[model samples]
Target: MPTLQIREAIREAMREEMVRDDKVFLMGEEVGHYQGAYKCSQGLLEQFGEKRVVDTPITETGFAGVGIGAAMCGLRPIIEFMTFNFSAVAFDQILNNAAKIHHMTGGQFSVPIVFRGPNAAAHMLGSTHSQAFDSFYAHIPGLKVVSVATPYDAKGLLKSAIRDPNPVIFFESELMYSVRGEVPEEEYLIPIGEADIKRPGDDVTLLCWGQSVPTALAAAELAQEHSDLSAEVIDLRTLRPLDTEAIIASVKKTNRVVIAEHGWPYGGVGAELVDRIQRLAFDWLDAPVARVCYDDIPFAYAENLEHLSIPQPEDVHAALRQVAYRD
Candidate 1:
């Protein structure tokens, strides 16, 4: 295995899929001559030529619709939004057309399209650019939602997403693009809708995804060191079609759980997870399921206020402690 950055892992997945299938093409703002908004597609323009690695105008809705149409016509299109916050402009395309096309056409057409790009907050990029939409897209009926954290998962899950014959919302984090992890030199794929237990423990289960995976791991470490608490951290890599079995097994083992994510507390992804936990795993739980999510408010431009709005490792740690009755 070779260590690679999340950006490199993403670029490799696209490049490999493009070579394996000529129908697979990447088109988005800043993808061609600009390499990628986060340099995730560096060198793709020269390797695949301007046609496959295309640069579009600053029109998200226009490009998204074009991608959906292309997918319906037997092409595998990967549409990148500079930031997922801008995906709002193209939500109508994704929600009404891309997602519903297959069922609307009665299996006559399948949208083999991937909508991907940086998601969640990145440093002090301001309020408008910081909020995450993981919950919104995951709520859709006809979409497979994936939010990747590790370099390995970023590569493997992305390859799987590209090959799937349905609409996929692939989420990458601007804040996680530079994080490095071991990725195999040989190609591999991690099946979507599976949860990975990053670390095993007995006291509590820390369920999380995307940016919050690292936070959960950190909190698990802190709990072990400071409170002598053994905490399991499970990464719910795919939000939709969630790995409920994995979650239930962990909850049964630990008897306590704390869900974490970058989304707001109100109708957050964590809320749905809470519902599932109580409905399915309630008998095994020792304590009520708790969550660590951002405040139910828009992200603020000020650094300190933004920090307050976003969930952090300390927040997760406290949630774990609260669940474990260690506080």
Candidate 2:
């Protein structure tokens, strides 16, 4: 095993997949000559050259449409949005073509393409650039949504997403790019629908993925240190197939749950999970499910206000205590 940052792990995954299959190519703004907007594609241009490592104009709709068309023609393309918030520009292509072609053609064609890049807010990027779109893509029927929290998961799950026979929405966070964790040097894959129990406890369940995963883990530590409470943390790595079984099992053990997310509370991922949890594990719950999330208002441009609006350790801790009846 080797320790690598989330960005390094992602670069390795793309590089390996490109080497393994010539049909696999990368095209996005600043990905080629400039390495990448975030430098996640560094050295790829020098190794794979301009043909495989391509640079495109700052046009999400055009490039994304091109990627979908390329996939329909049997080429695997990795389409990177500078930030997933930009994906709003290409929502038509993704929501209509990439998600419908397989079924529209009666399984005759599949979009084996991966749409990836940083998601959610970073620093004081303002409301427009700070939005998290996981719930948007995950809501679609034909897309596979993956949000990885660890470097190991980033590498393994990315490999699987690249090879998946469906359009995959791969969400990363700029904040997590530099976070390092142990990843195996050997090639391996994690199944698309599996959830990993990042931390185990019997007092309550903290459900989360992607940018909110670290918050869940940190909240668990706070629960222990301050309240003498234990919290089970489950990372729902893939949102579409959503490992509800894992969530239910943890809910049964803990009899309480707190759903954390980087998005707003209304119609967010947390809301969806709460619906499922209530439908499946309602009888097991000791307290009503609670959510720790961003305030419903638009993200603020000021750093201090944005910090308060976004869910933090104390917010999750409060949710934990609320669910556990320790508040």
Candidate 3:
């Protein structure tokens, strides 16, 4: 095993996939010459050439449509939006066209495409770029949504998404790109729709994904110092076709749960998890499922306010305490 930054793991996955499959090509704004807005695609143009690593105009809608069309014509296109906030501009192509084509055609056609970029609030980036939209995409029926937290999962899941026969939305948190983790040198693919129980516990279950996974783990570490409470943490690698079995099982064992996410409480991914758990494992639960999410208000540009808006370790700790104790 070797330690790799999240960004480096992503770059390696793309490079390995491109080398393994000729149909796998990358196209997006600044992907070629700019080496990706976040430099995740650095040196790809020189290795893959300009045709395979395309640099498109600033229009997200136009290039997204182009990527969809390319996929239909038998190419695996990885489209990178500079930021996921720009994905709204291309929503029609993603939601209607790419998501529907396979089912609409009755499995006659498949869209083997990946739309990836940094998602959620990062530092002082304003309200426009701060909102996390994994919930929005997860709402759609046809797209497979994934938000990866660790370098190992990031590399494995990205490779899996690229090879899957349907369109996938891969969200990487901007803040996690520099974080380092151990990644094996040999190739590996983590299957979609699987949940990883990062830490097993007996007192409460913390269901989370992406960046929030780390936050929950940190909170669990702090909680252990003062109390005998054990928090089971589940990292949902895939959002759609969510690993409900794993979540329900964890809830049944722990008898309490707290769902953590970076999005707002209403209509957020955490809400759906809580709903499913209530439906499937309500009798097993000892307390009402709790949620730790961002404040409903828009993300503030001020650093302190921004930190306040999103769920932090302390917030998760508080939610766990509330859920694990009864009156």
Task: Report lDDT per candidate.
Answer: 0.93, 0.93, 0.91
Clashing pairs in 2: none
lDDT of 3 by residue, 1-327 (tens): 799999999999999999999999999889998888888999999999998999988899999999999999999999998889999999999999999999999988889999999998888998998989989999999999999999999999999999998999999989999999999999999998999999888899998898898999998886776666789889998998899888888888888998889898889998888889889998998899999999999888998999899899888888888997732
lDDT comparing candidate 1 with the true structure: 0.93
* Alpha carbon deviation, residue 192, candidate 1 (Å): 0.8
Candidate 3, residue 105: how far the Cα is off, in Å: 2.3
Predicted candidate 2 versus true structure: per-residue lDDT over 124-233, tens digit per residue: 98989999898898899999999999999999999999999899999999999999999987899999999999998989999899999999999999999999989999
Any runs in candidate 1 off by more than 4 Å, and if so which?
none
Model 1 clashing residue pairs (backbone): none
Give the worst 10-residue stretch by lDDT in candidate 2.
318-327
Task: List candidate 3 stretches off by more than 4 Å.
Answer: none
Per-residue lDDT of 1-327 in model 1, one digit per residue for the tens? 789999999999999999999999999999999899899999999999988998999999999999999999999999999999999999999999999999999999999999999898888887788888999999999999999999999999999999999899999999899999999999899999999989999999899899999988989888888888899999999998899999989898889999988888888898998899899988898999998888887777888998888888888889889988887
